[model samples]
Target: MKLPSPVQWIEAQRKRGHELCLMLDTFDHKPVLQTLLKDRTHDRYSSLYSQTPIAELAGIGPFLIMLDSGDTQPLTELLNSPERHWGWLVSIAAQDFPALVQHWRERILVGQRPDQGIYRFHDNRVLGRALSSMPPEARPAYLGPAHSVCYAQGEHWLSADNRAPGQHPLPEQPHWLQVPVPPEQRARIRETNAHRFLLAHHQVAYLQLAEHRDPFDWLRLQRGRAEGWGWHAPRQLEFLLVSSLSTPEFEIPMQWHPRVYEEPSEHFERVCQEAKLLQGKGIA
Candidate 1:
């Protein structure tokens, strides 16, 4: 579905008495950090790592910046661009920025049992998947001070709201929260592995695949298909999946179909070459 323009969206939020803010991920790209610092103002903003043991890493960590009128245009451009993946735009019912910062700072470290680590919850993909996997009642733990959160998903913005009836903001600072790795995030790790592999070794195929479908869903489906075929090696499966992206049909050749354990690179190359020829003829 088409979303209202960012200007319209923000105007509507302001009319509803919500404070606008952005949770930016500098680790994704330096442009996000630069944008935040370039427009540095007296308006409330805090790095999620500030006042923490990793304070030195604040420059590259997640930052929560309350958006002001001057920030609309540049931020809107970034928010609307799908490839930027800067972070999420948030609307909060209250103007207590410190409380919102504290809410997220407490969740910086999360884990399952003895394996606590820096949670990349700031990444919209990770957050989106995590929210979808949780029961409605448990969503507020993540929603915290935000009235609603929106992030770029494919060609549109996806919003997740606190579903509980009353206000459910968490302002207290909790350290080293013991939260399990959401099943969706674990699956995303594998999916990203395949995507990174393609970007590194098969740029052409990566672009083609991205143009064809949502890369996340496509990679997940490819992983499932590979597993079902009993091709259990991670590297080999990645090769199979990425190689298929360059071809028109995106299927393994019949000759390779008989061999369950062998690498399918050779068969894939032949198919990819034929696909290129077809494209050259304007038939692909």
Candidate 2:
């Protein structure tokens, strides 16, 4: 079959939110590339393991999300699985910790602040599991039962009462950037392992960044038209609640985990190579 031209392929992608993956020589293997064929397009959305990149899908179409860490498991299986309601959060086991610690370091030196903490053991039990999909060597040493600041974004240090947060930054951008969501946004993260328990009952929890001196004020200002509330999309706003100043103490804010997809370097290359091959076949 003749592969479509890159320009032609781009057009089709624009029409729908499907993803296009191209491989580069970054990995120690051959490259392959792939994407959606316009003719076969459908409205069905992707699941966690879908080949499509989540960042690409975010605002491009019509769909509801069940966010989960991208496990190699097939999308069909995830959607059909018995624990369908259970999605995934970030886990330390799946992260490159040495890289993460460095990032937090840079952030603090700049005085802008950054934190890197996500996953341990407590969060795993509370949130279902930890390091569900990370490479073994990269997994952090699970210190008994504990909470990761949050595997979301980047992790960070918390306040005395587990209220505020601070992060360290690496001198470099790190590898996760190659994934769907880039790490180290303006705000660093705290593993939300502690927050996972609340998720069973509340789909949207507005826990403070803890690092944010007054996360309360941040939420108020966030609720105002200033930054606007919601996940990914603007105005997809959500509701929030406050917890007491004691343990389990924090405010719930506007946030929900939506399934996201990213093309790992290996997969991206695989698809691109195929695209090129299809192109070759077409020419032959």
Number of the predicted model whose lDDT against the real structure is largest: 1
The TM-score of predicted model 2 comes to: 0.17
**Model 2: residues with Cα > 4 Å off, grouped in runs:** 1-171, 182-226, 229-284
Candidate 1 lDDT over 195-217, as tens digits, reads: 65566567787787678688778
Q: What global local distance difference test value does model 1 have?
A: 0.66
Displacement of the residue 53 alpha carbon in candidate 2, Å? 32
How much is 43 displaced in model 2, in angstroms? Answer: 50
Stretches of candidate 1 exceeding 4 Å from the true structure: 1-8, 112-114, 163-284
- TM for every model, in the order presented, reads 0.56, 0.17
